[model samples]
Target: MSDLYDNLKRTVEDLAAPADEQEAMLRKARVGPDELALDFDAFAAAALNLVESGELSSEAYEAVRALDAHLVAFSGANNAAEWTEDALYHSSNWATARELASKVLSLMG
Candidate 1:
């Protein structure tokens, strides 16, 4: 249970991070812009699984779901290549994602 919480916390924190830090963390994990949406989807799946198994609250699940929706939409509008660390500073989409992620992080806590 602690491990599950910890993992979810870490993922939300990553999403909640500033653009530069999020890019850095993703780069460190070898996850580039092309895979960013997939990463978010994975987070949603994990959160949903926890909720279904009665390990997480509906509130947390909703938080994750909202972020997932925003990010996936953002992905559809922008080229994955534009997700580079350099481009993130110029992107409104990244800003929105970070905002939603921060909200999710706070709600999860």
Candidate 2:
């Protein structure tokens, strides 16, 4: 496992970090809506591309994709309280993203 759960557990504890830190963590893990800020389909495209390049296995992509599905499913379930300093709410989908990201990270190694 990549210790992503532990890392994420640590990250989520504050839930009030500046948006940059949160986004950095998500990008470093190659997961979450944080990437959507850079490009609409960037996150999703990267996973499949990684799989295709044999960088990330297909199994990992599926787990990542499930997280993406949650991002899609809960696209409207925004909450005002979790908004980072940058003004983007973390959303309930973040939990789902983190859970699935942890699973994918665990499986990879």
Q: How many Å off is the CA of 9 in candidate 1?
A: 2.4
Candidate 2's residue-wise lDDT over 1-109, tens digit each? Answer: 1334333323333222444666776667675544442332344445555666666678867776675565456444464333333343445445455566567666555
- Each prediction's TM-score versus the true structure: 0.76, 0.48
After aligning candidate 2 to the native by TM-score, how far in Å is the CA of 108 from where it should be?
3.4
lDDT of 2 at 93: 48
C-alpha lDDT of all candidate models, in order: 0.71, 0.50
After the best TM-score superposition of candidate 2, give how far the Cα of residue 64 lies from its true spot, in angstroms: 1.1
What TM-score should be assigned to candidate 1?
A: 0.76
- Candidate 1 lDDT tens digits, 1-109: 6566667667667766777777777789887754555655665777777877787789878877888887767564446556677766777877777788888777776
User: Which TM-score value belongs to model 2?
Assistant: 0.48
Task: Report the lDDT of model 1 for residue 87.
Answer: 61
After superposition, which runs of candidate 1 have C-alpha atoms over 4 Å from their true positions? 34-36, 76-78
Residue 49 in model 1: lDDT: 73
